[model samples]
Target: MELRIGCRRPPEESVPGLLRYRIASKIVKRQPLGGTDDEWVVIEPVYRAIELLEQLHDTPAQEALLIGRFSFNVRFKWFKNWANSEASRRLGLASIPDGPANLRMLRRTLSLEMAYRPGGVLATKIYMKHIAVATTEGCASRPGGAQAELLAEVNQHESERDLHLVLEEFRNYQEGVLPAGPGARSLTEFFAGIDAQLDAASAAAPKTQRNDRDVLNLLTKRAKVLHLGPANYCWFTGPSRALCLKLAGTPTVDRPLIGMCGSARCPQATHHSGHRSVWAEHADRTKIFLGQLGTTRKTERTRLQADHDRALRVIAGIDSAIAIEG
Candidate 1:
């Protein structure tokens, strides 16, 4: 029976060009079987064939050829033998024996496409029966099954650990230890302010509980406060630029800052004392830049002056917030 193997192309080429070049160079240096220049010239095609083989080596073409050959051999040899033995066993033939020590080897050889083929149903049914028999006979006591179970258990443990971490963060927020923004004196005040806003919103809305729940969920779940940017703004928030659901495509966790923050009003932002140096440095740099400019660069100087003023304003805001008592 003809079997097609589906092999996904690797992201990168398996074989380096340097290896092929080395092989080709070695072949070129080898003397012809005839040991004479005249005869060697006649056998030049053999040398060209070797070069062609070297070129094809370790490439996707070679991989496909190898996979096809492997699948064909396994289907006709191992799978055919196993099926015959299984049929005999079902017929109560005592002389027929078990196919092999490990049926997984045969299963691994069958490609994903082969499983969906016209005659694949019989093969799949035989494989499933074999597995069922193995499990009933306690053959699943193998190391591979144990390892799989262990891996699943570890994943569950990690998930539970992450949940606890989130809960701890929430606890810190409740205790007023977590920084929220420049407008709030403490985390407690920040949450109280949010509660007050939610209350006001609930009063106007027909579904007050639902609106309050949604807003609270956004704060506790989706929002991720981070210290980021030139000011080390403690309140920089969102799922982070990388984790933001609004962003298109696969999100990457490596991005260091929130790209487009919503400032103090953002659910994700929180200012803390740790961010003071960032703002201080920004203000200092902007002041120095403003002093260095002349009247000739009026537009540039104006921009720099505005930045300097903004930096100073942020610094003042942070200080005022910190000075407030409970």
Candidate 2:
């Protein structure tokens, strides 16, 4: 048996009728009002009766039909989930309120008209690009507007000076606690080491628990090891971020930074609260061990100290070079 895939819906059918039929068919399959797939078979005759005019008009128009082109508009449904807790069972959906609508149009110049001859059937294949035009007023209830304003304010203040200063301050905090030596590394190195550690832990996790506690614990550990003050940081580190999600397709050279925060506050704060907990407990330890910034052995203390001092100078110099405006 051969399968024919029509490129577009019949043009003789009104856009509204075609869309209604498409949506109604999906609804029936989805059993939105409640019924098994078998129930659809029973109710299909009634639906056909309701759409008698469409069927009758389509049959005659399809015969010996010449070249044609057409377009359509449609409305659809989507749901947004709202969860109540970090560990919860029940999920609430917002129903997208108005379920915004979109429009799509296509045109085709057929080489031959096959609608007229015996055993000839007008078959269509449609390709549509749905562009959303308007949305329900309920969408305004979201904080997206406020977020845009906040982001604008942040962008205005975030001079290169700020990045340099932040790195400098971070270095100072590390140096004050650790012995001076050539062992110091940048925060990026520190995080990169953590990534390796997480990999090892994930590998060691039992297969059965791989997707549950074992993985969750690993993430929580990572978040803890890389804690940076109270601000939230959203790093779109190209492949680095993708690595965390098991999708290391292509790598990037320079990491692009985009600030996505409200007001002057860092956006990282708004991230899931438990993220830190997961990273610290399971992932950071792996990185620290793997990255090996310093060793506590007394024999290597002097050597390590010297290395630490050199590293601090680099960080401090980099920091001192940055000028910040109040």
Best candidate according to TM-score: 1
Top candidate, metric lDDT: 1
RMSD values, in order shown: 19.2, 24.9
> Relative to the true structure, how large is the alpha-carbon lDDT of every model?
0.47, 0.32
Off by over 4 Å in 2: 1-152, 158-174, 178-246, 253-326
lDDT of 1 by residue, 1-326 (tens): 11111222112333763211111111212447523221111124444554454455565443233222245555556654765686767977565255543445544444233335554433333533443423412332232333345468876775455444434444445454454354244445546666576667778985746443355453553234434443333332324433232343434444333554434444444455556777789789999998899879999998898878876766776676556544
The alpha-carbon lDDT assigned to residue 314 of candidate 1 equals 65
User: Which regions of candidate 1 deviate over 4 angstroms?
Assistant: 1-190, 193-257, 260-268
Write one digit per residue (lDDT tens) for candidate 2, span 1-326: 01012212222344755422221222233356643322112133434443453444444342222212233231122112222233233444223433333432112122012212221121111111112211211222222343345457765555333444334433333344321112123333453454466567668874533333333343343333232223223333233432322322344633323322220222222222222343233334444443464555554555555544433443343333332221
